[model samples]
Target: MAGSDIKQSLRKLDFPLCARDALYQIEKLCTRPGKQMELQIDLMSEFVFGEIERRRKRNVPAAIQELQLIEVQSDFFQSPGGIPAVRNALFLSLYPAGSPRYKILGNLVSLAITIHNKAVLNAAGIWMQQLGSTSQESVGLARHILNDYFVLTSKSVDRLQQLPILTPHFTANLLTAIGEVYKDKNPPTEVLRLIGEWINDNPSLLLTSLMDNPALPTGGIPMTPITPIAGLFRWCILSPVRTAAEGSTQNEDEQKLYSKIQHLLMDSVLRLKSSGSNKHAISAQHLAATTRALTLVLQSFSNIEPTSRDLAMERLAQAVSSAMSANCIYGNKQELLLLLQSLSYQHFLIEWTLQTYSTKAV
Candidate 1:
């Protein structure tokens, strides 16, 4: 086939893996170092730049169409060399460490997984490693896939229970993504097992991270409506802490850690309550995380008879309630109610119940 004819043919496939091998051989021939080689370079550069411009104009899916064009032409470039050349620009566009495109870039990772492109998928994983809270928006389905990939795509969460908490971002993302899987109407069992394993892996990281960064909100707070870890944290908060009440000789280290976590929760809620940027930008994900953490602290101490726990819960409740009041004032009632309802059922009720239980015990 002529060089132009070969290029046209390569531009036709949606996926690279599906193209015929013979076409690849012909494409290599088109690259022989001669007069036509210069023409080939110009043609390829024009195509790539044009694709980039088109993507800029129309949005990412259009960009995906162009990527498909690249895939068809993959034979023209050669696997590692050609594939990355075609992939680099789009990869750059999609995974900026702190860019606004972080969320959409995550969706693109999802699409890459859908196409079974392991190379691109791995690239996405590496990109995520460099991001921080800035990439929380990208932690939905893409997170599940990446987590699975890291765990060798484990069939059961219990099967991979020993994974370490590598980063706060990953920890936050995995927690919420698992929440999503469990919150789904059908409720995938794999998700529960996965979460069970995750909890086993680093039950303390969430608390520790929050204690260290009191400004951090709940995972997937405003970003997602249903977060499993948020629910789990709620469970932890409402449930009594046996270690505290059983006269089990509470470890000082554990106590201090828990106390710091509580302080962080209080701080986050206070930020939300103060009005302005923190409250105005308070997404559901952040609220969920904050509420859950605060609630956990409340529940852990509920087993004790000390007036201190009561005072702490009271202050935390006021902080959250104040935040909600401000949120409602600003007309962000959806999340305001979410926080309120969780507080009403999960945290406040526990305090009330604890009071009654303490009176009876005494």
Candidate 2:
């Protein structure tokens, strides 16, 4: 069928048929090699989206199904040229949060991860931002998507390692998404374990990415080097691992993972402290990010035994004191003072609590 005829037919049909025929024609045209074919594909996309909007209130399921089919069956939506339309269609179909079609939205997210295309990853990031505002009915679907995301990325560590080259925004988007999931009161342990394993395998990549504030827009990106720090700190503070029953012991693997992260955090602080030379000056942003990350590291030690936690705190305190003594030529002194004051308050509370318990024992 000619492109014009397909467009006209799509306009006349209702719901699923309009979407189904539009996808079929888009697929067919996408395979052809020419500028004219490209133009035709674009035309079909417009018609498909228009029909989606026209029928959305009347038949959201069909529109959502069309997006899911396109995402699953073809790479067109994953390609750079088609991402915007695909993204728009997906967003438009997500409504009346009570709809049972959220599972399909979750599947679409999984498909995007499977495609591992940068454009699609961005679209998925956008979807996640939208999904956050949805009702409780969507939580299960959101969790499913998070689990799938972790599983997929865990299986593709090498691919993820090369993400900066293959898909520049993938790492950022993935980290942002993980940070979002961690916002929940009880994030899935499986997801957390997978993240720890991935970090264990690629500590440098993950840490450096987390620390480096990319120049991308923050609209859909949730992990901004500083924002996630507080969430992570809260995770450490609330984790049962921090206040296990007396004599409870962590598995050897878990201990090692925690130890590795601790080492990485210290290493990061050392790097930040030693970064500037006479010829160069560290920026305020870098200083703030490094400081916040260090604070998070200290909070994370709450998961360790009391003795280990005390020792880690002592070492961290000394390091912070030394860094402050140097009077690094970056960031406002008042900001640094506030950070130190905050740390001091947390340390005092911990110490006071320990002393009280010791006195009670005596």
The candidate maximizing lDDT is 2
Backbone clash total for model 2 is 0
Residue pairs in candidate 1 whose N, alpha carbon or C atoms collide under 3 angstroms: 179-228, 218-289, 220-285, 221-284, 221-285, 221-286, 222-283, 222-284, 222-285, 222-286
Cα RMSD for predicted model 1: 14.4
What is the lDDT, from 0 to 100, of the residue 266 in candidate 1? Answer: 40
Off by over 4 Å in 2: 1-9, 13-74, 80-105, 125-142, 149-168, 183-190, 200-204, 207-241, 245-249, 272-305, 308-362
Residue-wise lDDT of candidate 2 within 270-323, one digit each (tens)? 444555521112233433444465466556554556554454344444333333
State the lDDT of candidate 1 residue by residue for 1-362, as single tens digits. 57666556555533323233323433354434432544444333334333334223354465564565445533232345543322432243333444544434444444444444445543443343334233454344445454554455554433234333333333444454443332312223344334444544555433332322211112312221122223333322322233334544334544444344344434444444444433232244544454555555556555564443443345445433444443412333344344545445445643453343323221
